[model samples]
Target: MALEDIPRLGCGRSIDRIWGTIDRPPTAHEEQCDQCQTARTRLRRLSKATRSLRESDLHNPTMEPRPGIKNAIMDVVRAKVRRGSRILLRSADNGTTEISEQALSSLIRSAAAAIPGVHSRRCRIEIRSAAASVADEDHPTGTTGTSTNAGPRLIINLRVAAAPGIVIPRTVEALRHEISNAIPASVGIGAGTVNITVEDLYDV
Candidate 1:
Protein backbone atom coordinates (compact mmCIF):
# COMPACT_ATOMS: atom_id res chain seq x y z
CA MET A 1 0.00 0.00 0.00
CA ALA A 2 1.04 3.58 -0.53
CA LEU A 3 1.91 6.04 2.22
CA GLU A 4 -1.42 7.77 1.60
CA ASP A 5 -3.15 4.59 2.59
CA ILE A 6 -1.45 4.37 5.97
CA PRO A 7 -4.12 6.20 7.92
CA ARG A 8 -6.65 3.68 6.72
CA LEU A 9 -4.53 0.92 8.28
CA GLY A 10 -6.20 1.62 11.65
CA CYS A 11 -3.30 3.39 13.42
CA GLY A 12 0.05 5.08 12.78
CA ARG A 13 1.80 3.29 15.65
CA SER A 14 3.92 1.09 13.36
CA ILE A 15 6.22 4.00 12.43
CA ASP A 16 6.99 4.71 16.08
CA ARG A 17 7.53 1.00 16.70
CA ILE A 18 9.94 0.72 13.80
CA TRP A 19 12.07 3.57 15.16
CA GLY A 20 12.07 2.14 18.68
CA THR A 21 10.27 5.26 19.84
CA ILE A 22 7.51 3.00 21.09
CA ASP A 23 8.00 0.32 23.70
CA ARG A 24 5.81 -2.36 22.06
CA PRO A 25 6.43 -4.52 19.04
CA PRO A 26 4.32 -4.19 15.88
CA THR A 27 0.78 -5.06 16.83
CA ALA A 28 -1.21 -7.67 14.91
CA HIS A 29 -2.91 -5.05 12.74
CA GLU A 30 0.38 -3.50 11.69
CA GLU A 31 1.88 -6.91 11.04
CA GLN A 32 -0.72 -7.64 8.39
CA CYS A 33 -0.99 -4.19 6.85
CA ASP A 34 0.90 -3.51 3.63
CA GLN A 35 0.88 0.23 4.27
CA CYS A 36 2.59 -0.29 7.63
CA GLN A 37 5.20 -2.51 5.97
CA THR A 38 6.01 0.16 3.38
CA ALA A 39 6.17 2.81 6.07
CA ARG A 40 8.51 0.64 8.10
CA THR A 41 10.88 0.22 5.14
CA ARG A 42 11.09 3.98 4.63
CA LEU A 43 11.56 4.62 8.32
CA ARG A 44 14.37 2.07 8.44
CA ARG A 45 16.23 3.90 5.70
CA LEU A 46 15.93 7.12 7.68
CA SER A 47 17.19 5.31 10.76
CA LYS A 48 20.27 4.12 8.90
CA ALA A 49 20.87 7.66 7.66
CA THR A 50 20.71 8.86 11.28
CA ARG A 51 23.27 6.27 12.36
CA SER A 52 25.55 7.27 9.48
CA LEU A 53 25.37 10.88 10.59
CA ARG A 54 26.41 9.93 14.11
CA GLU A 55 29.34 7.85 12.85
CA SER A 56 30.44 10.68 10.58
CA ASP A 57 30.50 13.19 13.41
CA LEU A 58 32.50 10.77 15.55
CA HIS A 59 35.14 10.42 12.85
CA ASN A 60 35.47 14.18 12.45
CA PRO A 61 35.14 15.47 15.98
CA THR A 62 37.23 18.55 15.22
CA MET A 63 35.26 19.56 12.16
CA GLU A 64 32.82 22.29 13.09
CA PRO A 65 30.38 23.94 10.73
CA ARG A 66 31.26 27.37 9.35
CA PRO A 67 28.71 30.16 8.99
CA GLY A 68 25.93 29.39 6.45
CA ILE A 69 27.19 25.81 6.08
CA LYS A 70 24.36 24.35 8.11
CA ASN A 71 21.73 25.99 5.94
CA ALA A 72 23.44 24.87 2.75
CA ILE A 73 23.53 21.31 3.99
CA MET A 74 19.95 21.38 5.14
CA ASP A 75 18.86 22.65 1.73
CA VAL A 76 20.49 19.71 0.00
CA VAL A 77 19.23 17.21 2.58
CA ARG A 78 15.70 18.53 2.43
CA ALA A 79 15.57 18.31 -1.36
CA LYS A 80 16.73 14.72 -1.44
CA VAL A 81 14.66 13.75 1.56
CA ARG A 82 11.49 15.03 -0.05
CA ARG A 83 12.06 13.92 -3.63
CA GLY A 84 14.56 11.13 -3.29
CA SER A 85 17.46 11.21 -5.77
CA ARG A 86 16.24 13.06 -8.82
CA ILE A 87 18.15 15.26 -11.28
CA LEU A 88 17.14 17.44 -14.19
CA LEU A 89 17.63 16.16 -17.73
CA ARG A 90 17.54 18.61 -20.57
CA SER A 91 15.69 17.96 -23.82
CA ALA A 92 16.23 19.24 -27.33
CA ASP A 93 12.85 20.97 -27.19
CA ASN A 94 14.06 23.24 -24.37
CA GLY A 95 11.99 21.38 -21.84
CA THR A 96 13.47 19.35 -18.99
CA THR A 97 12.68 15.97 -17.56
CA GLU A 98 13.42 14.49 -14.17
CA ILE A 99 15.51 11.39 -13.83
CA SER A 100 16.72 9.46 -10.83
CA GLU A 101 20.49 9.74 -10.49
CA GLN A 102 20.17 7.80 -7.29
CA ALA A 103 18.67 4.88 -9.16
CA LEU A 104 21.54 4.75 -11.62
CA SER A 105 24.20 5.09 -8.95
CA SER A 106 22.52 2.53 -6.75
CA LEU A 107 22.73 -0.01 -9.57
CA ILE A 108 26.37 0.86 -10.19
CA ARG A 109 27.24 0.64 -6.52
CA SER A 110 25.40 -2.66 -6.16
CA ALA A 111 27.28 -4.14 -9.10
CA ALA A 112 30.64 -3.03 -7.71
CA ALA A 113 29.85 -4.08 -4.16
CA ALA A 114 28.58 -7.47 -5.31
CA ILE A 115 32.15 -8.39 -6.26
CA PRO A 116 33.39 -10.63 -3.47
CA GLY A 117 36.03 -8.37 -1.99
CA VAL A 118 34.97 -4.85 -3.03
CA HIS A 119 32.80 -2.38 -1.19
CA SER A 120 32.04 0.94 -2.88
CA ARG A 121 31.99 4.04 -0.67
CA ARG A 122 31.29 6.91 -3.02
CA CYS A 123 30.42 7.54 -6.68
CA ARG A 124 30.79 10.85 -8.51
CA ILE A 125 29.34 11.60 -11.93
CA GLU A 126 30.84 14.12 -14.30
CA ILE A 127 29.73 15.08 -17.78
CA ARG A 128 32.23 16.68 -20.15
CA SER A 129 32.14 17.62 -23.79
CA ALA A 130 33.80 14.98 -25.96
CA ALA A 131 35.86 17.68 -27.68
CA ALA A 132 36.65 19.64 -24.54
CA SER A 133 40.24 20.78 -24.22
CA VAL A 134 42.32 18.87 -21.71
CA ALA A 135 43.62 21.64 -19.46
CA ASP A 136 45.82 19.31 -17.46
CA GLU A 137 47.43 17.61 -20.46
CA ASP A 138 50.26 18.98 -22.64
CA HIS A 139 48.80 19.27 -26.11
CA PRO A 140 49.20 21.53 -29.16
CA THR A 141 45.48 21.05 -29.94
CA GLY A 142 44.50 22.89 -26.77
CA THR A 143 41.98 25.58 -27.59
CA THR A 144 42.76 29.30 -27.65
CA GLY A 145 39.93 30.30 -30.00
CA THR A 146 36.19 29.66 -29.95
CA SER A 147 35.86 25.89 -30.17
CA THR A 148 33.56 23.37 -31.77
CA ASN A 149 31.38 21.38 -29.43
CA ALA A 150 30.86 17.66 -29.19
CA GLY A 151 28.39 15.46 -27.35
CA PRO A 152 28.95 15.04 -23.65
CA ARG A 153 30.76 12.03 -22.29
CA LEU A 154 29.96 10.71 -18.89
CA ILE A 155 32.76 9.97 -16.42
CA ILE A 156 32.34 8.10 -13.22
CA ASN A 157 34.78 7.90 -10.35
CA LEU A 158 34.29 5.38 -7.61
CA ARG A 159 36.03 5.20 -4.25
CA VAL A 160 36.10 1.71 -2.86
CA ALA A 161 37.67 -0.47 -0.19
CA ALA A 162 38.79 -3.96 -1.07
CA ALA A 163 39.32 -6.99 1.06
CA PRO A 164 42.87 -8.38 1.49
CA GLY A 165 42.29 -11.56 -0.52
CA ILE A 166 41.43 -9.80 -3.78
CA VAL A 167 43.93 -9.28 -6.59
CA ILE A 168 44.19 -5.54 -7.13
CA PRO A 169 44.39 -5.32 -10.92
CA ARG A 170 41.66 -7.89 -11.51
CA THR A 171 39.38 -6.26 -8.98
CA VAL A 172 39.69 -2.87 -10.59
CA GLU A 173 39.02 -4.31 -14.04
CA ALA A 174 35.90 -6.09 -12.85
CA LEU A 175 34.60 -2.91 -11.26
CA ARG A 176 35.21 -0.90 -14.41
CA HIS A 177 33.42 -3.40 -16.62
CA GLU A 178 30.41 -3.57 -14.32
CA ILE A 179 30.12 0.19 -14.16
CA SER A 180 30.54 0.64 -17.93
CA ASN A 181 27.62 -1.63 -18.72
CA ALA A 182 25.37 -0.31 -15.95
CA ILE A 183 25.65 3.39 -16.75
CA PRO A 184 24.69 3.23 -20.41
CA ALA A 185 21.91 0.74 -19.87
CA SER A 186 20.38 2.38 -16.80
CA VAL A 187 20.95 6.09 -17.36
CA GLY A 188 21.29 6.20 -21.18
CA ILE A 189 24.67 7.86 -20.71
CA GLY A 190 27.70 6.13 -22.13
CA ALA A 191 30.62 6.13 -19.72
CA GLY A 192 33.80 7.63 -21.10
CA THR A 193 35.76 6.25 -18.18
CA VAL A 194 34.97 4.27 -15.09
CA ASN A 195 37.80 5.09 -12.71
CA ILE A 196 38.24 3.19 -9.49
CA THR A 197 40.49 4.16 -6.64
CA VAL A 198 41.12 1.66 -3.90
CA GLU A 199 41.29 3.91 -0.87
CA ASP A 200 41.58 1.08 1.65
CA LEU A 201 42.08 -2.67 1.86
CA TYR A 202 40.46 -4.52 4.68
CA ASP A 203 42.33 -7.20 6.57
CA VAL A 204 41.16 -10.75 6.03
Candidate 2:
Protein backbone atom coordinates (compact mmCIF):
# COMPACT_ATOMS: atom_id res chain seq x y z
CA MET A 1 0.00 0.00 0.00
CA ALA A 2 1.28 3.48 -0.93
CA LEU A 3 2.45 5.33 2.22
CA GLU A 4 0.03 8.17 1.52
CA ASP A 5 -2.88 5.71 0.88
CA ILE A 6 -2.33 4.01 4.24
CA PRO A 7 -4.45 5.33 7.11
CA ARG A 8 -2.56 7.85 9.25
CA LEU A 9 -2.23 6.99 12.91
CA GLY A 10 -2.72 9.84 15.47
CA CYS A 11 1.01 10.73 15.13
CA GLY A 12 0.46 11.63 11.42
CA ARG A 13 2.23 8.61 9.91
CA SER A 14 0.33 5.91 7.95
CA ILE A 15 -0.98 3.13 10.19
CA ASP A 16 0.88 0.40 8.25
CA ARG A 17 4.11 2.45 8.16
CA ILE A 18 3.85 3.46 11.79
CA TRP A 19 3.11 -0.07 13.00
CA GLY A 20 6.63 -0.60 14.35
CA THR A 21 7.30 3.07 15.10
CA ILE A 22 4.68 3.96 17.70
CA ASP A 23 5.97 7.56 17.86
CA ARG A 24 5.60 8.21 14.11
CA PRO A 25 2.86 10.58 12.87
CA PRO A 26 -0.16 9.29 11.01
CA THR A 27 0.03 9.05 7.19
CA ALA A 28 -2.39 10.82 4.79
CA HIS A 29 -3.89 7.41 3.83
CA GLU A 30 -4.36 6.59 7.50
CA GLU A 31 -6.32 9.82 7.91
CA GLN A 32 -8.60 8.86 5.02
CA CYS A 33 -8.90 5.03 5.22
CA ASP A 34 -12.14 3.83 6.88
CA GLN A 35 -10.44 1.12 8.97
CA CYS A 36 -7.54 3.36 9.89
CA GLN A 37 -9.97 6.18 10.56
CA THR A 38 -11.98 4.02 12.96
CA ALA A 39 -8.77 2.80 14.68
CA ARG A 40 -7.53 6.35 15.05
CA THR A 41 -10.92 7.42 16.36
CA ARG A 42 -10.90 4.64 18.90
CA LEU A 43 -7.31 5.49 19.96
CA ARG A 44 -8.24 9.16 20.31
CA ARG A 45 -11.28 8.21 22.42
CA LEU A 46 -9.10 5.98 24.61
CA SER A 47 -6.54 8.77 24.96
CA LYS A 48 -9.22 11.27 25.95
CA ALA A 49 -10.65 8.80 28.45
CA THR A 50 -7.18 8.24 29.91
CA ARG A 51 -6.58 11.99 30.24
CA SER A 52 -10.04 12.47 31.72
CA LEU A 53 -9.33 9.72 34.22
CA ARG A 54 -6.10 11.45 35.18
CA GLU A 55 -7.90 14.78 35.56
CA SER A 56 -10.65 13.18 37.61
CA ASP A 57 -7.97 11.55 39.75
CA LEU A 58 -6.47 14.98 40.44
CA HIS A 59 -9.87 16.54 41.07
CA ASN A 60 -11.05 13.79 43.43
CA PRO A 61 -7.77 12.02 44.09
CA THR A 62 -8.34 8.30 44.60
CA MET A 63 -5.77 5.90 46.00
CA GLU A 64 -5.64 4.35 42.51
CA PRO A 65 -2.55 5.41 40.54
CA ARG A 66 -2.30 7.32 37.23
CA PRO A 67 0.64 5.93 35.19
CA GLY A 68 4.05 5.50 36.89
CA ILE A 69 2.65 4.40 40.23
CA LYS A 70 3.90 0.84 39.88
CA ASN A 71 7.52 1.96 39.65
CA ALA A 72 7.20 4.30 42.62
CA ILE A 73 5.63 1.59 44.74
CA MET A 74 8.38 -0.88 43.86
CA ASP A 75 11.08 1.65 44.74
CA VAL A 76 9.55 2.21 48.16
CA VAL A 77 9.26 -1.53 48.79
CA ARG A 78 12.92 -2.13 47.85
CA ALA A 79 14.11 0.66 50.12
CA LYS A 80 12.39 -0.91 53.12
CA VAL A 81 14.07 -4.33 52.66
CA ARG A 82 17.58 -3.02 51.94
CA ARG A 83 20.20 -4.68 54.14
CA GLY A 84 22.60 -2.99 56.57
CA SER A 85 25.55 -4.70 58.32
CA ARG A 86 29.04 -4.04 59.70
CA ILE A 87 32.49 -5.66 59.36
CA LEU A 88 35.20 -5.45 62.00
CA LEU A 89 38.90 -6.36 61.61
CA ARG A 90 41.41 -7.23 64.27
CA SER A 91 45.23 -7.16 64.07
CA ALA A 92 47.08 -10.43 64.53
CA ASP A 93 50.44 -8.76 65.20
CA ASN A 94 49.63 -7.07 68.51
CA GLY A 95 48.33 -8.98 71.49
CA THR A 96 46.43 -5.71 72.11
CA THR A 97 43.48 -6.35 69.77
CA GLU A 98 40.40 -7.33 71.84
CA ILE A 99 36.62 -7.25 71.33
CA SER A 100 35.17 -7.11 74.85
CA GLU A 101 34.48 -3.94 76.82
CA GLN A 102 37.23 -4.81 79.28
CA ALA A 103 39.63 -5.61 76.43
CA LEU A 104 38.99 -2.22 74.88
CA SER A 105 39.48 -0.54 78.24
CA SER A 106 42.81 -2.30 78.61
CA LEU A 107 43.91 -1.26 75.13
CA ILE A 108 43.12 2.40 75.81
CA ARG A 109 44.81 2.22 79.19
CA SER A 110 47.93 0.83 77.56
CA ALA A 111 47.89 3.59 74.92
CA ALA A 112 47.54 6.27 77.60
CA ALA A 113 50.40 4.68 79.50
CA ALA A 114 52.63 5.17 76.44
CA ILE A 115 51.99 8.95 76.41
CA PRO A 116 54.85 10.53 78.38
CA GLY A 117 52.91 12.59 80.95
CA VAL A 118 49.56 10.70 80.96
CA HIS A 119 48.75 8.68 84.09
CA SER A 120 47.57 5.15 83.31
CA ARG A 121 45.54 4.90 86.53
CA ARG A 122 43.72 8.19 86.09
CA CYS A 123 42.64 7.55 82.46
CA ARG A 124 39.46 5.62 81.75
CA ILE A 125 38.43 4.01 78.41
CA GLU A 126 35.02 2.58 77.54
CA ILE A 127 34.48 0.59 74.36
CA ARG A 128 31.19 -0.38 72.81
CA SER A 129 30.21 -2.13 69.58
CA ALA A 130 27.71 -0.23 67.47
CA ALA A 131 26.04 -1.14 64.19
CA ALA A 132 26.43 1.06 61.09
CA SER A 133 25.43 0.59 57.46
CA VAL A 134 28.00 -0.41 54.90
CA ALA A 135 28.45 2.00 52.01
CA ASP A 136 26.98 1.14 48.62
CA GLU A 137 29.30 -0.48 46.07
CA ASP A 138 29.66 2.89 44.33
CA HIS A 139 31.36 4.25 47.42
CA PRO A 140 35.16 4.30 47.39
CA THR A 141 37.07 1.34 48.84
CA GLY A 142 37.73 1.47 52.59
CA THR A 143 34.68 3.70 52.80
CA THR A 144 32.07 1.13 53.98
CA GLY A 145 31.95 -2.65 53.97
CA THR A 146 31.67 -5.30 56.66
CA SER A 147 34.57 -7.66 57.14
CA THR A 148 33.51 -11.22 57.84
CA ASN A 149 36.26 -11.54 60.43
CA ALA A 150 35.97 -8.14 62.08
CA GLY A 151 33.05 -7.25 64.37
CA PRO A 152 30.73 -4.25 64.08
CA ARG A 153 31.90 -0.66 64.48
CA LEU A 154 33.47 0.36 67.79
CA ILE A 155 32.81 3.44 69.96
CA ILE A 156 35.53 4.33 72.40
CA ASN A 157 35.11 6.90 75.13
CA LEU A 158 38.28 8.23 76.74
CA ARG A 159 37.95 10.19 79.95
CA VAL A 160 41.35 11.37 81.13
CA ALA A 161 42.66 13.62 83.91
CA ALA A 162 44.74 16.34 82.29
CA ALA A 163 47.10 18.80 83.98
CA PRO A 164 46.09 22.47 84.37
CA GLY A 165 48.55 23.63 81.64
CA ILE A 166 47.58 21.01 79.04
CA VAL A 167 45.92 22.15 75.78
CA ILE A 168 42.69 20.16 75.94
CA PRO A 169 41.60 20.85 72.38
CA ARG A 170 44.93 19.82 70.91
CA THR A 171 45.11 16.75 73.07
CA VAL A 172 41.57 15.73 72.20
CA GLU A 173 42.13 16.23 68.48
CA ALA A 174 45.36 14.25 68.64
CA LEU A 175 43.70 11.46 70.56
CA ARG A 176 40.82 11.36 68.10
CA HIS A 177 43.08 10.90 65.13
CA GLU A 178 45.34 8.43 66.90
CA ILE A 179 42.49 6.32 68.17
CA SER A 180 40.74 6.36 64.80
CA ASN A 181 43.83 5.12 63.02
CA ALA A 182 44.80 2.60 65.66
CA ILE A 183 41.37 0.99 66.10
CA PRO A 184 40.72 0.42 62.38
CA ALA A 185 44.20 -0.93 61.76
CA SER A 186 44.30 -3.09 64.85
CA VAL A 187 40.72 -4.35 64.39
CA GLY A 188 39.70 -5.10 60.83
CA ILE A 189 36.60 -2.87 60.70
CA GLY A 190 35.91 0.63 59.39
CA ALA A 191 35.55 3.34 62.06
CA GLY A 192 32.47 5.48 61.53
CA THR A 193 33.48 8.18 64.00
CA VAL A 194 35.80 8.79 66.97
CA ASN A 195 34.97 11.01 69.94
CA ILE A 196 37.31 11.78 72.88
CA THR A 197 35.89 13.15 76.12
CA VAL A 198 38.28 14.80 78.59
CA GLU A 199 36.20 14.50 81.77
CA ASP A 200 38.56 16.12 84.30
CA LEU A 201 41.49 18.52 84.69
CA TYR A 202 44.06 17.74 87.38
CA ASP A 203 46.83 20.10 88.54
CA VAL A 204 50.09 18.08 88.26
* Whole-model lDDT values for every prediction: 0.66, 0.53
Model 1 clash pairs?
none
RMSD of each: 16.2, 18.6
lDDT of 1 by residue, 19-127 (tens): 5642246667657887777776677788788889989997894776776587457546644764465544445686756566555566777788667788777677665
lDDT of 2 by residue, 15-78 (tens): 5544443345766776566777677666666667888988887778565677657745753553
Candidate with best TM-score: 1
Candidate 1, which ten residues in sequence have the lowest lDDT sum? 143-152
TM-scores across all candidates? 0.46, 0.38
Off by over 4 Å in 2: 1-98, 116-131, 135-151, 190-192
**lDDT of model 2, residue 123:** 26
What does the lDDT read for residue 124 in candidate 2? 31
